[model samples]
Target: MEDTMALQNDLTPVVEMKGITKHFPGVTANNQVTLKLYPGEVLALLGENGAGKSSLMNVLVGLYRQDEGEILVRGTPAEIHSPKDAVQLGLGMVHQNFKLVETMTVAENVVLGLKHLDFIPSFSEICRRINTISRQYNLQVDPRAYIWQLGVGEQQRVEILKLIYRGADILILDEPTAVLTPQESGELSRIIAQMIDEGKSAIFITHKMEEIKRFSQRVQVLRKGETAAVLETSKTTPSELARLMVGREVLFRLEKKICCPGEPVLEVKNLCASNEAGRPSLQDLSFIIRAGEILGIAGVAGNGQRKLTEVITGLDRADSGKVVIQGKDMTNRTPLDLIQSGVSHIPPDRISMGIVGDMSVASNLVMKEYRSEPVVKRGIFNYKEVAKSAKEKIDAYNISTPSQNTEAKFLSGGNIQKIILAREIGACRGLLIASYPSRGLDVGAMEAVRLQLIDQRNIGNAVLLVSEDLEELITVADRIAVIYEGRIMGEVPAEKADIKIIGHMMAGASLKGAAQAAAEAELGEDGI
Candidate 1:
């Protein structure tokens, strides 16, 4: 561990906020918060959703003004009233969502918002400037490529380069690697490290504990709009950080007992489906998920996983083939019909497909069964019964919300997932199709979700988990099936799965070719 005194040396904090408080109507977003950022050191702002991590940062970058507080930059009080003022004071913020024009080239997007662009600039000159900054920081952005053509990692490089080009000494990043692949994340860490080596400072806001331990020099936890604790990175553990952030000790592991499979519950034969643009997205797909077993579909994003889930759940129509559940044909049944026929679907897009965002949480809880049972008695709505069930499920799922009557859109991403899972997993069903169930959840919440899926499988309910994360698929699924270009490339047992073959399949290689390539690559690595 590096000595804290050595890391600090004689440098004072480049930015400081004392007793910051921000308020909204009927809510206090931040209350008497304090923060300090030193040059050449990375600070991780850790918290659960709505913990005011962003609110504090926003006050610094001029997005939000503190109702009561003092900001000091370099031992002097600084007043920043706008983004331009913050930039002028050598502070820059990269938002959670990148602000770039997709139709423009990288160079154009970089120079778009500068006030000095009163004169028409030469494209070649701008490209030269971008290339110089890119090489200096190891950001590796193509100055001539269109923004839409670049990958997520490359796009992030452009965002960082823009700040550096504008002569920013302090950088703020929000959820920087949320959409990055594991390899991309490694490269991003290297880039951030290089930036620190060049004497630039950063404050990274994220919910990931691993990123804090691996990337940041110190950790500051926030809980319910207040500063909870700040600790040296090498001296603290993730469990302790999570405990402080959520106000409770979090369970990090799940309990999984091996169980044997049973009769087939869902069988798809020669399934064919088309995307919204009338192109084939699922072709000749066949698989069977049995009782007490989980079948995981592993593939890169946008490789027919959505189509498969939609076809099975009756959200999208199949062009050909049949879907059989317990020897019953369900080729083109409606979504409601499938739900009533013992199928529960956790859709990919929770906000759009899973729940009604404007509706109350209690109403969304009983969406599936509103037409029947205690929720609706003799065509009359029963608010008391719905409230009772919603309260029970909310407590069971550990969802953090104001109340059952609160709007679903006001909850955090993790709580929204819990609401959907609570409604799906707790229902009476036989087949559960979970698409990206743990996509945006924190590590502790992810454990709870995986446990729920396993519990369903243990109780003889078949589960099909479609996910882009290969590690998650390996952890939960009994059998892994690789898909590519609307076709099943190969099937492998999860116990003996090889990532090289899966990566090859996702790149559109045939089954035999992928296996051969994987074997040859392995042998080459061993110097055979």
Candidate 2:
């Protein structure tokens, strides 16, 4: 045992966690898990959703206290009781959701929570320092720019810069590629490689198998709060890693075939809507979605996505244009009319539009179908019937909750999405509009939701999937439509689109013209 311990120390793991265990009220998060990270290496932590990947990382980052464990830095035991303590120990984490102050400048956000605010606030010095660090790490960002002005990718760069600025040598990235385009993801991978080359250590927390293959030297699989296996990336395939993590052979791709689309299930011509400020949001937007097809709407958030959903769902009326659903004109229809017409929506903000946060899960499950039979009783309330129906839906959706009567807010974000998905997909007969459906889900939960949506489309249901995630659009959508500045730029077949061309379009370029340029550029020297 002494010789084995000496052999392990020779590897010089920067961060070592031994026999870590954590528990919530009813669930054991980490069950005597042991993980180690070596300097100058990218260690990929692979796991499914709800597999305790985040929880274990949280323990290392001082977000949660471990019930039992010993943490070692440089092979010496250390106690990290808070984020500050973790930072003191050369540890930093970039969370899945960025924690930037939107109104603050990039430099301000990066420098936040650190002691020594210069008496005069050295804005210039701070910017210079950030720029220096940015160049050093190949993380380019305008530190003087406001947080709100930066793109999602840029915002992520800012997060990385923050840790670099804080003097952290051991960095933990949690699902960093979830919202990035393929091009951006590639850039990030290169950045990680650069870091590794510079002798910095990193623990990459992600469910993306492709990333594990591309970025990591070694891969560690975590299942149900324990380390299942750790192996060299070059020696294993994604299928093998997936099998180890899931304890079975999992299908990485969906078995989908070509579809024969029917007549227009949803038709909109010259539609207009407004934002919260009562200003024009979606301006003269026109599109058609046929039954048995998944039309993916791709764009940055707040770029008329919300208004488009509101207009179609009757939460807000379009200023103009006809909304014909199932061959019937339901223009400027009431919310009730939209629901009766077989239109179900998974809203952008699940907490605000999908679930009543303060209400019981049972009530929320039946919120959309309270007026329908079996749940309603001659204009009277049927508590028993509603509860029973909710239980059935809960079971069918595999929602994780102690009981149906549990408050919606008590459940995790992923479980809340499941409830909404179950309700909308089961109730709607013609069309389903899912916006950011898998936003915060972990691997397992995301796969389940994606499969559910694909299943809906396969059954001849028209699905309008609006998302900022381009990879999702590529995988699940038959046709991808780029939306910019409140209008549809152009539509393209999923197979014909590339990440670079599509990313340019998302950044407000003309899609048709850009596609033409891309084609021309591919033609070679004479074409140029």
Q: What is the per-residue lDDT of model 2 for residues 394-475, given as tens digits with 9 covering 90 to 100?
A: 8887786767877887665557878898889888688999988886565556667878888888898999999877788888
RMSD of 2: 4.5
lDDT of 1: 0.83
Looking at candidate 2, what is the lDDT of residue 8?
46
Query: lDDT tens string, model 1, 1-528?
Result: 222446574678898888999986556778998888888889998887667776788899888899999999877899988777888888988876577889999998888767644675688988898888878767788999999887667888888888887788899988787656566778888878887898989999877788998889888888888988878899999899988887777776555678598998899999998876798899999999999999999887667888888888898899999999877898889988888889998987676578889998888887777878888999998989999999998888777677888888766666787889989887748999998888657666777789889889999999999887887788788899988888888888887887888888878887679899999998999995
Q: What TM-score does prediction 2 earn?
A: 0.81
Q: Per-model C-alpha lDDT, please?
A: 0.83, 0.82
